[model samples]
Target: MKLLKLTLAVALICLVSCAEKGSRDTAEKETAVTEAPAEKAFKYWTWITADPERTDDSYQEEFAKYKDNGLDAVLINTNTDPELLGRLTPLARKAGLEVHAWLMAMNRPGDSVALQHPDWYAVSREGKSCFDHRPYVDYYQWLCPTRKASRNHVLGLVEGLAKVEGVASVHLDYIRFSDIFLPIGLLPKYDLEQEEELPEFDFCYCDVCVAEFEKIHHKNPREMENPALDIEWKQFRLNKIRAVVNDAYEIAHKHGKILTAAVFPYPEMADHMVRQRWDKWDIDVVLPMIYHNFYNEEIDWIGFATKQGVQDLKYKDTELHTGVYVPEMSPSEIKEAVQLAKENGAKGVSFFDGPALTDDMLQAIKETKEGR
Candidate 1:
């Protein structure tokens, strides 16, 4: 009887203990769920070109203005100059700013590597290579993403920049095929209708890409009646670029650095235009070039584009920073754009460049920074 009584008493104690433990666990989970997440930080960044005058002293002078205006980072097109990066790192850090290596990945303008391997340049559907005949822009010399040599050449540049001391991140630009469909505003200037996919602008029909596509589907892309409508072929090109970008992401993460890209405003439209499926690219952050004027869009389009990118990345870990072109925009217009970006869930905002910005534009950016 004593043993039975003792067993019942122990079971009762255990029941009470388990109930208390369960209540505590529920309370803890409730606290965790209700606790507010840390506020997202607002960052300001701008792009700069490293001209001959951008020496150590000049760099210091340039960074001082950025620091004074509450800028947090600067993306500089430093090429593969480790020496210059070595010099600029401490200076930028001293000025309370971070330096990101701005690199042109697929678009290698005057690239000595591409110059040597002329076959590495992407060929249009019309059998024209970017090497001999430049695309819409004289400098739009794009490399074929499927070629092993092209991948190695670009990755070598990225790896070198990653090894640079104090480079906060490697910002990739022009990491897409030449635009198959130019923006509507640009079409008039280029004298293109582009109601349908034009053979001249469509690209990446180089020997390697052709052979691979044929091997996959047992068909040639060039023979397709409407190559643009060939979803499999289009996905092939998208995957090729995605592979290169993923390799870059791995390289950056392996060295403990962030990998970012300057992408087109909308993923679906970007896919149709540039074959840049950046939504699938494994990147830490993306700065969509949400330049309204380029797209012939209004100021409010900034919010819409930013919101679209945010929604696309809602399931991913990537952060979005909207890139604003400040050339033709007024100070008030710029402020409104920044507000739109913030309201639409942008973590930060980046201006297209530093050299083009005037005092008024800078003051407007300052106003945005001060929350005025």
Candidate 2:
């Protein structure tokens, strides 16, 4: 009986000790989960055009306003003037905002050097040059990416911007071909209906592009009955734009800067509309202008577009930042836009223009950043 009692006591003690060990294990797991790190905050940015005449103090004040309201970066369009960019970069940095040198890549209007060589401009399928016969607008003077001289000129500008001290990245805008199909919502404003590929809007049938395409494919795009149906012709233009971007990428990296661009909504849409396959290009970041209102889409469309771009870029290291048009957005709508961008996997959000953001909009942006 004494031996049996001793054995039972030992068993009871073992059972209690095991129970306590199990409880400690569960507590450790819970503690580990509670101590896990939180997700990183989303970045905010805005596009601003710099005026050389503006005083440095004014720019300091402007940049401070953006930084105070939660903007992490500013893309400044100085018309590809590196000197002006050099002057503004320190000001923005002093205000605690990253400065990006924005340049009009291919669509250079009133460019003194390019204007000197009229043949450098892209020609439409209708045999009209963008230099003399402006397409859609007077400022749509896109240079031929296929031409050695024209492409080099554009790259030189990129190099200039990349060399600017304190600049984060060389931001490229209008880097694609002229739009083959304007957005549906913009059609009414132009009083037009584009059911198919129109000749007037089709581009880069210039001598240089035509010769290069013919040399490689042994066919002439100009002689084809339906050039749009020719896969090689379409791919040729896409490759030309890609080559320019890839070259610019190398140039930017060589100068210790990254390459970023303001692209269309998504890869397929950008390809169909502007012959820009941004997903295939070698770029660091792409801020797709997902202006839903421009396409007659509702605010929720922002999420869909952002998700589409994110999915397309899943295999790439390129970061996608959703660019929203803020001129027409109300304060509530702005909040929803930012949240949609975040929920849809965008790394950040950028307003179209800095001057268009109102106080209420800035407040909305700030509150969203703070999770209020």
Residue-by-residue lDDT tens digits, candidate 1, 223-323: 99999889999999999989999999999888778999999997887898999888898999999999999888999999999999999988999999999
Report how far residue 30 has shifted in candidate 1, in Å: 12
- Extract clashing residue pairs from model 2: none
| Global CA lDDT computed for model 2 | 0.95
Residue 345 in model 1: lDDT:
95
Tell me the tens digit of each residue's lDDT in model 2 across 1-372.
Answer: 999999999999999999999999999999999998976568899999999999999999999999999999999999999999999999999999988999899999999999999999999999999999998888889999999999999999999999998998999999999999998889998888999999999998999999999999999999998999998999999999999999999999999999999999999999999999999999999999999999999999999999999999999999999999999999999999999999999999999999999999999999998997
**C-alpha lDDT (0 to 100) for residue 350 of candidate 1:** 93
